[model samples]
Target: MKIMNILQIHNLKPQFPCTFRTFPHHSLSGSLNFSLRKSTRLSSSSFLLLLVTPIRPTFKIFTVSRIEAPFFENNKEEEEEDEERNSATNLTEFEDLAPDGVVYQNTLRLVECSMFAAVTGLVYFLSNSLSIENYFGCFFSLPIVISSLRWGVAGGRKTMVATAMLLFVLSGPVKALTYLLTHGLVGFTMGSLWRMGANWGLSIFLCTIARATGAVGYVLTSSFLIRENILALITINIHASLTFIFAAAGINTVPSMNFIYSLFGILVVLNSGFFVFLLHLLYSVFLTRLGMKDSLRLPRWLEKAL
Candidate 1:
């Protein structure tokens, strides 16, 4: 039995020589020579058998840990879209949404209007209480200008009416009428021109003309009330001043009253122009302090001079 087992093992070893050839030798040249010799020794039947045999694929086994995340999602595009939607929704959630009609409902604007009316009334009161000259009454128009600038020509008219009513109650109809003839007319004329987007020069020119007309009307009204010609009085004063000047200069000629009157008219016009410029300076300063932008900016040289 032992001799038969040995004989079988020896025959089996020669039958599968390609099984040893499957592993490469240490030397590449030796391995190549062995492969060539093995191929030459193999019969056509053995080569056919080797070709028909199936190869078994080998795999390596490894230990890998599986980690789990609670909020992680598998759809990458959906995750990106969700992030974008969350950001956009957060941005639009707390926007301010105010109504358009709220402009008329502002109590602060009403308060500002009342304050302007009171200021104008106070100026009237001072003019009356102090018995200041009628020319000093020009200062009363400042509040009206401010009101007009703040709220437009309509607001200015309201301020004028309010001021007149206040003055009427305090100093009677005569004082109120005087104010209307002087400051009130100038205020309304300037405010209307300004509100209509007129240039500073044109607006000032119109205001000066309106004021001059008001002065003429006031003079006529005063003359009618006092039974005296105010223009004749003014002409007399001008004639006296010219006679004094000419006497000092050693001139014998006495100019005609018409010449004196014409000179007085020219001086009045020039004075009105000066007043317009003065009012413009006041307007610029007040508008700047009130944080309002002026439609007509002061020239650089004028601003520096002021």
Candidate 2:
């Protein structure tokens, strides 16, 4: 019985030890699992937060001390001084023109005006003095065209006025009026058209129209006033001149006043075209020689030839 009891006691002791060992083992495992789960949850939450929130760089704000303010003030003053110097040196184109330069340009304009006026007066006198055809009167355009190209419409008008005054002084009012209507009007028309930068074709067309209108009016008025065959004589003379030229070219053709009158419109266009072409050539030469800028443009074909 004692041996049995001892065996029983030993078995109970071993059971208690085993129970204690199992309980401790299970508790340690549970604690380890709980800690691992907590760590996993914390790591996932931290990763999600990092993904959701964007990280931005921090900038430092600096305040200038009172001691550095004077230095900055000096720098600003220096910058302003440099700006003033640049402004003083870099002037606008018009402002950069010196007083002497202004005076010189004005003087040159006056000289040109005087010269052109004289030329116009001389041409007028020559046209009136000569008993030949009215072709000599066309020379009056020289000054008007030059003035227009050099100084624009205002200059042309001034020149026209000066020429008219000179004509009035040189010849009687009647002669002056005649010259103004017949020649001066054409010059003014051309100059105005040129000053406006009209295209070559349009300029020629307008000038031709003006010339034709003026010529017809002058002829009809003069015929009515004089009670003579002035138109017939003028047409006959023109026909004779053309016939002579055609004969010289080995084409003998006698032209009549009726035929000439019938073709007067066509003749005017051709004649104006020829005269304007010549005037353009003169203008090109004059502008180039004088180193003046002109906006006048000729036809592409005419440009090539000129």
Candidate 3:
């Protein structure tokens, strides 16, 4: 009996220890009821814990992933900034490499020269009086000379040679020979005039002096030695004066004698000035439309060429 009693006392002592750990003696009945309810909940939770999967190990992985997310965002931002910088650099490089205005100007000049030459050729072919005398009969030589002054010796020489060749081809052998001699003289004189470090005005003046000398020579030669044609003197004088006037003003020099000749020369100068002005205007408008800078640096080759 005493042994059974001692066993009962041992069980009661374990309950006392559990009650003391959870609640004091002064705890309310409700608190005791809550403690009993908590014990029941703990017992059920332990059973559930045995059946459920563990979650503690994955907590470290979740924390690391969360921390790395900001780095990825920073990396993306860095990439975007780098791209922007590269784009700006590329744009700057392009601007430095390519110049639009100079290219356009050169192209336009070539086209204008070609068109003028073609028109002159067609006019000569249709006139039926296409002889070396007639082909050169117009002040066309003046434009050739002036083009050199404007574009420089190389361009001028190129234009003059091209014009002479075209005339030769169109006028046949007799006219070609005469035209070549006359034009060759003009080219040599103009080239020499430009090469002498003369300004535009002086170049034109030199051309005038050359023409005047030629005219005087023609008169002396034709009147004294070659009496076959008296008209050659008149032709030579008219060509000289007309060429000087035509070159002084930028325009097509053509063979014509009268009061109208002066008016035509004035008209041609005005027209060419207008054409150049319009080209500049168009260039400005194009640049504005493209959002480009107003002033551009000249190309090195073009600066040297000019």
TM-score top scorer: 1
Model 3: per-residue Cα lDDT at residue 195: 44
Between candidates 1 and 2, the one scoring higher on lDDT is: 1
Off by over 4 Å in 3: 1-63, 66-100, 123-138, 168-178, 191-306
RMSD of each: 14.4, 17.8, 18.9
C-alpha root-mean-square deviation, candidate 3: 18.9
Global local distance difference test of model 2 = 0.68
User: What is each predicted model's overall lDDT from 0 to 1?
Assistant: 0.72, 0.68, 0.49
- What TM-score would each prediction reach against the true structure? 0.59, 0.51, 0.35
Question: Mind giving the per-residue lDDT tens digits that candidate 1 earns over 140-234?
Answer: 77777777766777788888888788878887887788889878888887767766777778877888887787778888889988999998998
The clash count for each model shown is 0, 0, 1
lDDT of 3 by residue, 92-201 (tens): 76765454556555766576556545554445445547345454344444444445544556556666566556767887644444433444345445544544554444
Q: After superposition, which runs of candidate 1 have C-alpha atoms over 4 Å from their true positions?
A: 1-114, 132-139, 294-297, 300-306
Better model by TM-score: candidate 1 vs candidate 3: 1
